[model samples]
Target: MTSAPNDLAFLRRLRPLAARELRLALLAGAVAGVMVVLQAWWVATILDRALVGREPLAELVLPFVLLFGIVALRAASTFAAERLGFAAAMRVVPALRRALLGKLGRVGPSGAAALPTGEIVAALSDGVRAVEPFFSRYLPATAQAAMLPVGIFLVVAPLDWLSALVFLVTAPLIPLFMVLIGKGAEALNQRQWLRLQRMSGHFLDAVQGLASIKAFGAGPRMVAEVGATAERYRRDTMAVLRIAFLSSLTLEFFSTVAIAIIAVLIGFRLLWGELDYRAGLFILLLAPEFYGPLRMMGTAYHARMEALGAASRLVALDALPEPVLASGTARPAFGDGIAIRFEDVHLTYPDGRIALRGVTFAIEPGETVAFAGPSGAGKSSIQALLLGFVGPTSGRILIDGHPLETLDPEHWRRHLGFMPQRPKLFAASVRGNIAPGEADPDDSAILRAAERAGVAGVIADLPQGLDTAIGNGGRQLSGGQASRIALARLFCRDAPLALLDEPTAHLDDDSEAMIHAAITQLKGRRTLLVNAHRPASLALAHRIIRIEEGRIAVGQAEPAETACPC
Candidate 1:
């Protein structure tokens, strides 16, 4: 498709996945509609026979029993429709969530970070949920509204054509007015969704940066900003709700007026002796039943508006490109370790910031190389490129004599162990954090990795040892301890190429020494690419490549001792 379709079109595309369940729900609703006609027929017959014909109460027992049975069956069918529709909606919500998460993964880190985290969270949580009612209530109600009113008119025409004419004339008014009012409600709902997204993003940003705000004594200012955003969202919500109430009132008023007109017509015809009592009563009994579906449809129409608003946001998110570059199908073997070469590599981010310019570098197989530079000197950018988190804007990254762009990113990453500057730890036990990817982790292997990373003694000191819970984001541990745990995780991977980006930065002397020792131990066993600033860390590298202002400083790629020292 050249351009993505609108929210309604997007919803239509997803209909096939839950077609069977939705069809069953429609079938149940049709049964309920038929029961409505039959129940009204039996009720009118029973009332006419008892009061107008002077029939015995016992003579109407069968009709009363049949009417009760019809009511029960109608109730059952309505319940079945509701349950089936809900089932269909549940199926759809999870599929949408999966598509969103899969898209998030394919976009990689840089692309995901480009979107607001709170807005993404809102889409995955509330946005997907708002769509449920469209499938569960709105779709079925529309079908019922279409089928019920026409069926009631057909039944009434043979008995009282004048009442049937009134039904025909007034029936369309409910939906016509429904459409008119719904247009305004839909716009309000869309604005409400946008405001909610802004509020969610602002609140999340404020909470995440609470520590910094407190440190800078900006707590009151931050709170006021958050309150303002929340207030705006609340006002948007109230406006939408007001529109919804108005729509409901308009539907009720028209349907009630139509029923009253039918009642008045039937009364005048009976009073003039032009219509039989039984026929007039029958026509009157069916008036409200005819308009019942229309009123229900009006209420459900609000759900459609809410769903359209939510689906619009979801569609916008889905339209973003997964990766700036498509990953190739090639999986190159790194039998003799990965030999990488950057040929005049240039890196520019989506935000128009140039990270690297004409930066040339090479890493020999199983070599320990350090990229030493000040902050924003392209060291981390190089690591991001190597890890396949992103591609070079205009350059070539070759791996083991194969073009990096031509290699499958997933397969290529399997051979590399990466330790980022700030590593994330899940809410799991310490042992689980160390070997997060292992299906059946070996206790001995984990202990060995932890010991190599110099965290085994620290783990032993905790009350629960390796099984201690780290809490979300490793909150139970200190920064140094968390870093060591991440290093241990890298060791457990046993990959051929190990990338450590500023592993010792911001660490205490003890933590730094422990990491340096781990580096010394793994220097020859694997190809090591480290981004370091401390002289001691740089000394471990066989060669140091110093970068400055998006380019390699001349005469800086040499022995570590002669390279620029921090």
Candidate 2:
């Protein structure tokens, strides 16, 4: 394929996935195209019989019934084509979303952060919806426009070659104008998608930061800024509307001119006794219908352009290289006591922010270590590297004396139970939260873990107890309750290494009692890597390693302010 074809190949790539619906839609459209022809022919015959043939009304019943039947077929085909088109479009959107999300996972967590969360949400939701018109309207319309116009012209040709010649000449003008003008609309549509990305990002930011804005008494100012941005968006939108209107005006002008020229030619021919009234009238009716599909395509044309813009964006997103993942066994045993070491690691984010720089550390077997650092000190980056979300820009991370990259990340993670700073509770019950996504999770063990975490009593008080729905993201639970439940999951999970980050953050006094129990239970059997923010959490670790600006500051096992020992 040439460069032009290659660039837009993403649209073609979706064809097979939606072939079923598109075929149905195409069939409906083709049938509708033929129906319009039959409907027009029957109308012409009925009119000719009544007026020109001077036939009786009673004799016309069958003709009228046939015309109605043809009209009914046209309407049915129209509805079926529309319904099928929409169904195809609906299927593609979610399929696109799933494919995009799967791609995001393969890109890994760090690379996926290249786009803001709000932009991802918008692209997956509204941005994908913008392309809906292509499948639901444009594709079917294009098929109909392609087939119907030719059918009309062929039918019109034998009746009156002069009129067919007029159609032949006029037909190309609609798409011609559409293409020339639509080029501008296509550029505007791509810009519109970007603008939508910005709009969605800012709106999400505003919503998320509303509390801060209110507290700082800057709510009005923020609202004004959002309003100004919205106004700019509105102006951009109106500019697209102006082009559409101009294109519509151009199309209407040409269609009318084409029909007028045909009408004048037919009149002159009829007056000269060369053409019959029935044929002239049939040609008149057929002229608009001939132009009709092309006009429909013209109207639906922008939808195709908009979908193209979306496809272009999707192509760019897919162009991101897949994160290389090691293919290794998932059941790697931890019997040798999993050891972790970071040597001169460095990480620079896609936006050029450096999160890690020459960081070095090591954890021996059965060691309980705490990574003590302030926010943005590359604490999470170390964990991210170990988990293989990303590799170091320069340096290495070793697990069990082997390079971390050589081990399958999923398999490595399967051997470690981690609770990050933010606890994620699902829309399930207390027992469900205690053991999510485990192979054959034990209910009794879940309750035992919950008891150790000091939140089992709280769950027992709920109307449905362990089976009670926690609601989405555990909205029904307090922060302390949520934290305890997460800790419970760590307790119940049978991983050899437990990686817990600030696990006690949102706990109450009562919840802390359970934290102590869970901590004691986690002490010696499993190797523990903890990101601690409090003295109590820090005390659970055998050694404390402080990180500052991606470099190790001090180690509890060594002299104060000593460099990290790799």
Candidate 3:
């Protein structure tokens, strides 16, 4: 992952996606090169006949017409070549984004915990965008560099071997310098790219923590720090530009020298009467076209660096462990209610943190069980396993005597109405937030769910009632109000099984009382698995299961002495 290949695995990986696009682009470039040669021939023939052979203006009409036709063809072919290159880029970008997103989803929350959120976002967005040029410009430039020169060489060699030999010898040197300079630029570009990710991540973190910054009176300091970060990025960008300028200069210098050499050789030969003006003019016109491909290759070598920098991160993202969630084939549906059993379940995260160990428990049909544990005591881990967010490292979770993995995850989730510690609400109307996924949404059902969750009074107080825009993350609502709104979503589901984690957590006394009332409404109507440590919350449970470390205690129900830490 550090190296683009460690050998050429990156190219091998890309071949499948880009092969067809690149082939079409290359074919189009070859055709364009043919047009360039034909246009050069038409122009050279017309000039030779009029200037040297002393042909009348009327006699030159055929050559002039052919030259005009060739010019038009060249213009059309150039347009086609550009369009073909862009089409190839378009083919790969979306596929790459989809595959990356799918892979991240599979990794699950636990698997992705170590990565920075902003960097992941950048990689999926801007990082992916930066690579578009690699396909549209770099790959086509590469194809033209390889194919165009050979076509030009073939035409020139027949007309004049000396000029062709000069082209063949000079073409290799341009790329030689390009490779040597590019080796150094690759590392610099990669370093700058990684730094940009860190800067972006820091900015995102600052935005998310803006409230805390204002409370702590660090807003000005944070702004200054952000400015410093941007300044550093600017420096890195300047360095990249400097290297790019040097690369272009080297290419331009060498190509100019090669063209000058060819023109000099043609002039000497024409003066000695060893070459006809017709053939001499043709070779002279072709000399720059011959090196055109090499110059393009030199420019595109920088694109290679840009792509490799992006690809290194892509490779690293791809190299992460496979997703822990298993997608079972059989469609799952609820009947009555589900009985659950945990058989020797264990959980370990990527950073070697163990969350559960040899734990075992069960709940019969329609039973309401509460798991009480302190922070990091495997309470949430159990919920994660049951919800199909992440699989246990070992052992099995059986639902109604059937292993959970035997059921399709999407179908299994439909039977669940889960309310996590902090349920997310989008920037939508209260009704939309309450009933997000229904194919045909019902206004009455949304209002009913809101009323049942004891939050109808809160929403009714808003300016627009159910039609009010909540703003991003439901920013307009208080903590208790947000919790009540999430509970409303669960009421809307009315699924067979409900998982509520710290349902009243981080809420004011009023909010806690509201959620407690909602829980009172849900009892016996649905099977509930609640994770809590609050005496208020634990008091609502029919049975209490204590979790210490990763294992369940061997005792019966007990009163909550303190909040959490069971």
Candidate 4:
């Protein structure tokens, strides 16, 4: 919409997971840290007791009991944390998806058409999935790692301040190295994701255009395009892998060096007899344990980068601006019928291509109007304006007496039916395709609509009537059949206003006549705007409007012209 904002900032705007789930996760992590510290304390106590006295075999009972309690508590806490984290993650995903979908919905079909289908699919699906690891593993692990090291150090400080200080000072290096290495990794990860989306988009396009490739005998060329896309994706993936490997190695190296330094210092203190056997053993054991959580935390940092990369893309999609609507307004009523007026309406593309320049026209309620012009004469643009797919660059469009901009786009669209130049059909049964999931069109109504569109015969010949399954994109149906099915859907809609974009474009004479009959039947009830190049389709309209070079020529009502020789 406007200027694109920073991705990270956009991502942070998403509401975090539920507070209760986060609280439980943190509580579990705290308990787990305390358990680890207690386990360490019991081990040192057992070692000290056995060294000095002639400890009986039964004397090991208390330490073993403490060990069992520590382990059991730790296990329970781990389980709880995992369960809570997963629950929070699950809750977040749906909200994120809803937000993404809502944003896209607000953008409408014209805005969405600017982006590739594959790219949108990747952002919605794969991008959403990436956040799972961050929530379930990295997030809880980060909390546990932060709490555990501090808790362990507090316990050790009472026994030996010197050892605790050493552990604390060295632990900072692990995260420092991790941050330094991962700084570049986030950028790389973002680039990799972009490449992945592009590759997916290219692949989907190739698949969709497979028939065209076969018809032209250029299947091999299409195959080569797919191969090139795959290879580019592979290269991008390998680059991400290289950076990730280096980051992991750097974190591990720093952790190892820190652990070594702690070990050396403790060994010297014990060798010179400055430290007792019990304290030396306890410090030695606890040193590694303290660093263990830090090491895991460092690893989790890399995972955070990966999640953030995906989140960045998702945030971008969510940040798309919604259409503005006037407040304190009721839905416009079209009792007499819906009349449309364009008062000096101007429309310009984002790239500064003007489609319609100061175009003005008016259509009365229940009138059948046709827009006839050569391609790029803004005929379809006029229909798009009527449908409120795009706001005017300047001027106003009015329905009844109210400005179109003042009306809710969704509410306005609900009263309108449109048939595009190319209609899309989902892979679903005939009834499902016709009515979809939203409209619970009864069998009788569905059959009536199909019959009106002259497609009922085709359905009746099928093995299962309306229950027959259409392949992807209605591949099982011929082009004319698909058009008729789309028309059937439009008929089922039963809107007050109808916008037809070459509704009979590719049909034969008989099929064309059937569609024309359907339009004639709609004449008395619905206001119609038809975009047609053929004379037979135009004959149904009462008025013919001519558009040329982004301007409409206002003239008196005339008999419909059969052909465009202009």
> How well is each residue in 1-566 modelled by candidate 4, as lDDT tens digits?
21224554554454365557877898988887777777776787787888755588597997788788888998998799889888877877788788788778767666566667887899899988887677776778878778888877887788778878877787888788778878787777777788888888888887878889789999898889788878887887787778777867876777677768777877898889888877777777777778787777777776777778887777667655443432214487666369889899898865577999898888999999988888998998888777766678888888888888788776887788888888889888899888876756599999999998889999999999999998878989988889889889988888889999988887888868877887788886889999988888778888788888888765523557443433
Q: Mind giving the per-residue lDDT tens digits that candidate 3 earns over 1-566?
A: 28765313663465568778777777778778888988888788888888888899999888788888888877877788788778877877888899889878666676666677877877788777777778888888888888878888887888888998898899899999999999889888888878888898999999999999999999999999999988998998899889999999999999999999999999999999988998898888888888888888788788778878877777767666753445575675666567899999998877888989988888766767788877888999988887776778898889877788777777778888889888889999888888877767788888899999988998989999999999878999988888889999999988878999998888888889989998888877778889987778887777888888988876734533333444
Worst 10 residues of 4 by lDDT: 321-330
lDDT of each: 0.86, 0.80, 0.82, 0.79
Winner on TM-score between 1 and 2 is: 1
Ranking by lDDT: 1, 3, 2, 4
List, residue by residue over 521-564, the lDDT tens digit for candidate 2.
77777788888677677767777788888788854244223423
Task: List model 1 lDDT by residue over 130-166, tens digit each.
Answer: 9899898898898888888898888889888899999
Worst 10 residues of 3 by lDDT: 556-565
Model 2 clash pairs are: none
Tell me the deviation in Å of residue 162 in model 1: 2.6
Q: In terms of TM-score, which candidate is stronger, 2 or 4?
A: 4
Model 3, residue pairs in steric clash: 374-565
lDDT of 4: 0.79
What TM-scores do the predictions have? 0.92, 0.85, 0.94, 0.91
